[model samples]
Target: MDRRTLWSNGAVAHISLQDEVTAERFTDGEVRRVTYPPLASLCKSPMGNRDREILWGQSFNVLETDKGWAFGYALRDGYAGYIEAQMLAPVEAQATHRITVRQTMALSVPDLKATKAEHVALSLGSEVCVTDTDDKWATVMGAPHTLYIPASHLTPLNDKEADPVAVAERLLGTPYVWGGNSAFGIDCSGLVQIACHACGIACPGDSDQQMAQLGETLDPGTPLQRGDLLFWKGHVGWVSDPDTLLHANAHSMSVVHEPLQAAIQRIAAQGDPVLRYARLTRL
Candidate 1:
């Protein structure tokens, strides 16, 4: 089993894995929601390297808790990791809206001009429960009090962007962060996941998993097109056009649009040539 998705930690595992794996204990995990915003790092081990990130209002199934860390898998992508236990809370309400922009401020009051208004930056894909709404602001139940966000920045949970590439383009210039999943910082796979999720397409969290599970592979020599996925050994990028590639790359340390041929040549020179060319079934 893939350790990233498996709910086992030698001592215990989720009850769902009882039939397939051996463990000293198994129990049905409790569900929780991420209460922190901007983004929450999901670490590979307690205080270890971040394997991925979870946005506000996203669900995490907690199978174990140790010290101050919660060990579980994210419901959005089944990526398992450790998260700060205090950053999560019981699911009090279902998310009604998802942030549509790259980032937006959630103010302490409904008016944007309030001088002392406290604010929190919410990133794209963060979800919230809209309890009240006026023409300009939306009231959401925040940790300590109700917060107001711009009505124009949110969309109903069921709504989705029409173009994944267009969604990806909005995050151009985000700093490259290992295992990051927000507009503030992101990795290549994170960029693809955020864009695909915005378009209502389910996607895996890592590049290899994304390569194995997403889109059908194109035959060798297939011409690249808009929305096509190009995979290198450990990296991936979206083809914005026949000649342009969009990705969050370590070489640039940010998400950027660059000449596709130039990227291919540059990456190949580093010994990681293009591994796969794929086209999504839906777009």
Candidate 2:
């Protein structure tokens, strides 16, 4: 699992391949399969940083072809466009992997010498690719030594064993940053977005996006449940139970759990009374 920053930007996002040789194209929607691994590199174009300037994630599906390799990818968050033959890699997806946070976690390598390297530096909301966990440390790719993080610090965003509440608590004081998905920075929407993802639900990335995904809109007076999804205009949070909701607020840098009534009052005081109401989505 060699990690490459999606762009030269400081933001480090993690993506894994489905098979040994898949193309990671410049444009998102291209699909191609290769017999070898891609050169561990970032997606760069001959044009001067044009594509790199934008913030987006592309989903590409691998397709095997008679030619040496080919790729088909959907760019711009799976909605608008597709491209082909951008880049290729030689490895496949692993059934197991650990995400990392610490600057240097140790990992055992194919070379047999234990190596210590910078694990992916996702603040809080960012994710990493871990191959396995050895005792107290997580074994990530490209490093020779196993990296250590509080077992409590990592979540199985893709695992059935993950504890959503425990994971959500790690960011108690994290500041609310728009479009932030890492602990170093996070947004109200990203807080609930990732929490829901950890629990095996596919939530849209923002408040308005999330509102559309809920099966139905409930009146604010309705009872809530633990793990219920709640939304406010331009903001969103998670319900820990009928009475408590958790969210990252501009007013509160870290995620906070408060009585639902208090939270609604707080929002109403801000002059955005519509932000006081939440539509609930039960998972």
Candidate 3:
């Protein structure tokens, strides 16, 4: 079959099997084939964070049938497991374009003549996919990343455009909440994890998980820029520029951009020096 990209970032579908099959699932692992990419935080079960998570790079081989794709998937870190076909989504890749602004600006519905009517509150340099552009808002198919602008602020990259830097900015001002992954709330590590996910990159859920996955660390004095994943022992965040970090800090209660020096000092006061033993994940 010809290869294609699936746009359903977090959508799910079911498969019907003609014969019973084995499920060799693993957690923190990946699928064997690239037939389709699973959405971030996608769960096979509707239960609370307990469903079989089809992490990035993971796949399940099924018997080709006249009806549709059918088979079980190996989930839970490639551990011993098997789930029904009724829990997955049938997806294929579609073309997408990523856009970055020439200057610091906000995203809004293109239809609105003024900012107040259409402002979507996106951060400057934020990365967004343009599925279709009208006069104002750009329609991003998969996860609703439609950003509105004056049609003059954006510079559209081709389909398959991936900008991790602009992706980091979209999470600004998200509140600091434990286990919260959506824009409504997020933690330092959660911020980095989700940003990577949006950019079609795989990252673990916690700081330690992320640290273990990505090898080595970068020198802080080297200057962290946009899309650089910043780590500090138990916490992680993304850098929007050389001097500012985007993250959800306890003090702020939401995602915010802070000077590197100030963030270091603040975390250090908590006995967790932000720079003392920090790591960097470059995607």
Candidate 4:
């Protein structure tokens, strides 16, 4: 669920995490809106583990502040973390559309030739609203200005794909990251989190938390099937089929398709033994 390239200096970094910032530092009320498109990752600490993702139009409740960093809980999942104050808008904007594709760029203009750092890639399930549109491009309301994304990349929020594993499969070659949850980079739990979110299923932002909260555990002897989840001490993978596993992992440094038993043996050799397998509570 997480990221930004900003943090301020020693004026606040010198202060202890135990102390609170002056209440005056907070914007009115405590609620802030995300202005950064693509994704705003909520981290474990400032520049810490990117545990969850918030799209361009999501909101968060500010609990405290430290210089340019705001500590808060995401309104979407109530997961708490520090986000760069610059990444959020003091004013709120409602989201009406959701990005349904694996990756789509938000362009300053509708033209493909105008691509630059200004147009970063937005990941699946990130929400935005269409303010205006022509036949080929839809204008998405962005932080400082309205940006255009291809009309093909979005769907009305009410229209969602039904298969979670199929959505995960779309990210087959994304690079593995320790805590990233965007198409720009991702982690083991982040992969499942985005996959479940696309199908309108609520999922937690971490592996162990997902294991505890998501679904019913299967008996040790139960047969593996597509959509079954396998877990280790701090990692997870999805069953692509009865015999194959799909996951974003450091071992491959990317999402990969591998034999289920081979993965179990490989991880066991690395000292993290397979802990369990489970299924969606609805499945």
Candidate 5:
């Protein structure tokens, strides 16, 4: 199968597709979950930057495994890559809380200073299930182990932010990563995904999928407002105001705000024209 023909292979995932595409390959895969907070799905077995990050609780459809690399699709967005075999859980786990802020560490205990070396860094939108709790900390089930994170650092999925644009503004200087979705690093679509999901909105993990999943298309001449989604061929961003556009882009190599018209002309000059504009619908 050509990489383009592989339905689940996202741009940042492994480039090749199986020569012989068959239904049996995908159908035979078993359900698994990402136990690691930021487990990477590398294009190669050992690991490299050409990899996609798999968030905790993201579903995996593992078709095959060898030499510690499990090959399959990330069911959340159908992006196929190779996640380390050890990064998966034996059974699917329920995720109850989402990390709200940019990035935080899940420590071995509640104390941040004393347990400085005993924490796992988790990015925004990473999920966890509260297993035990106290006033200052909550013991959550983390990848391959239990972790204690600040109780205030997490919120229920339904405890949404009021302004999606405000949520996107939280990461103004975050570095851009091709397939990244966390505040530590992000991409155009990743920024949109985090911002929308924080507001209790269900947005897909990629720009094209997001365009289809978002609300009714608006005419290009329609007045832009906060939360309006601006889409290009492989990019997406949100309107922070009538004139300001917020996005995690490669040109700046970080999330930034720029004039919407400037972005349109700059992108069009590169041949990736703005495909459409969408207004988010609360469902």
Candidate 6:
């Protein structure tokens, strides 16, 4: 069981794992939705290293709560980690739309020009339940109140982008955060996951999981093309073309497009060579 997806904490575990894992306590967890956005970090330990992020309105299965932290897995990708308890709330409504823009504000009123309106920033991939809509704005349910956001920033939950690469291209310059998944910042695997999700593909949260579970491996000398996945020991990227690689890289501290051959050489020099080339069945 990968610890990142496993619901156990040595002493307790989700009831679903009872047949395979030992624990002192097993219980069915409660589901809750993230109330804060731009992004909320899910840390390996309470306030420790971030392992992933749960976007606003995304559901989390809460297995345990201690002090002010909730330990659970993100319902979207099953990545388990600790999140600040206050950042989540009881699910009041199912999500009806997904935020399509990089970022947008949920305002106190429908009018964008309202100077004193209270607002909260929402990020791309965040889900919202729109109760009402006009030509320019949507009224969505907030944690404790109703909020309005631009209608143009949202898409129906069932809609998907046709090309995953195009979804990633829109985030070309986002900062490379170690475990970030939002447009504000993202890692290599996070970028791939986000892009895949937009195209209605199921993806694992970590690079290793994605490499092992996402797609079929290609032959050693397979010709690269758009949307092909390239994996290194601890990193991953998308093939933008036969000659270009697109990824959120620590070396650059941002997502970028680089010559594929040059990237291969650069990464190899650091003792991590390209490990595999994969092509997804759906794309």
What would the TM-scores of all predictions be?
Answer: 0.98, 0.56, 0.48, 0.84, 0.82, 0.97
What is the per-residue lDDT of model 4 for residues 99-177, given as tens digits with 9 covering 90 to 100? 8788888888778886453685788777787988888999987877778889988888777677789989888899998
Computed on alpha carbons, the lDDT of every model, listed in order, comes to: 0.92, 0.45, 0.46, 0.77, 0.75, 0.91
lDDT of 3 by residue, 1-283 (tens): 1001111112221222112222232122222331222212332232224222333223443222112333233331221223233333333433233233322233444455464643343322233434566765555433223444444545543322266556656666656776544454567766666456555565555676666664346665665556666667778766677788777778889888889778878887888865333334444
The list of candidate 1 runs beyond 4 A from truth reads: none
lDDT of 2 at 49: 20
Candidate 3 residues lying further than 4 Å off, grouped into runs, are 1-161, 275-283
The root-mean-square deviation over C-alpha atoms between each candidate and the true structure, in angstroms, is 1.0, 10.2, 10.1, 5.7, 4.7, 1.2
Question: Per-residue error at 258 for model 6, in Å?
Answer: 1.2
Assess the local accuracy of residue 20 in candidate 5 as a C-alpha lDDT between 0 and 100: 37
What is the TM-score (0 to 1) of candidate 5?
0.82
The model with the greatest TM-score is 1
Cα lDDT tens digits, model 2, 1-283, are 2112121111111133323333442222223222111111112222212111111111234322223323222221221111223444323443133232312222233222335533333343333345655555554433223434434445553554245555576677776665555465567766765555555556555577667674466665667666566666777777777888778887766667888768878887877554333443334
**Model 4, 182: alpha-carbon shift in Å?**
0.8
Off by over 4 Å in 2: 1-95, 98-133, 136-138, 143-158, 161-163, 274-282
Positional deviation of 22 in candidate 6, in angstroms?
2.1
Best by lDDT: 1
Evaluated at residue 100, the lDDT of candidate 5 is 81
lDDT tens readout by residue for model 5, 163-238 = 8888888889999989877777889988887788788776666787788778879985899888888888889998
Q: Which stretches of candidate 6 lie over 4 Å from their true place?
A: none
Candidate 4: residue 209 lDDT (0-100): 80
Rank candidates by TM-score, best first.
1, 6, 4, 5, 2, 3
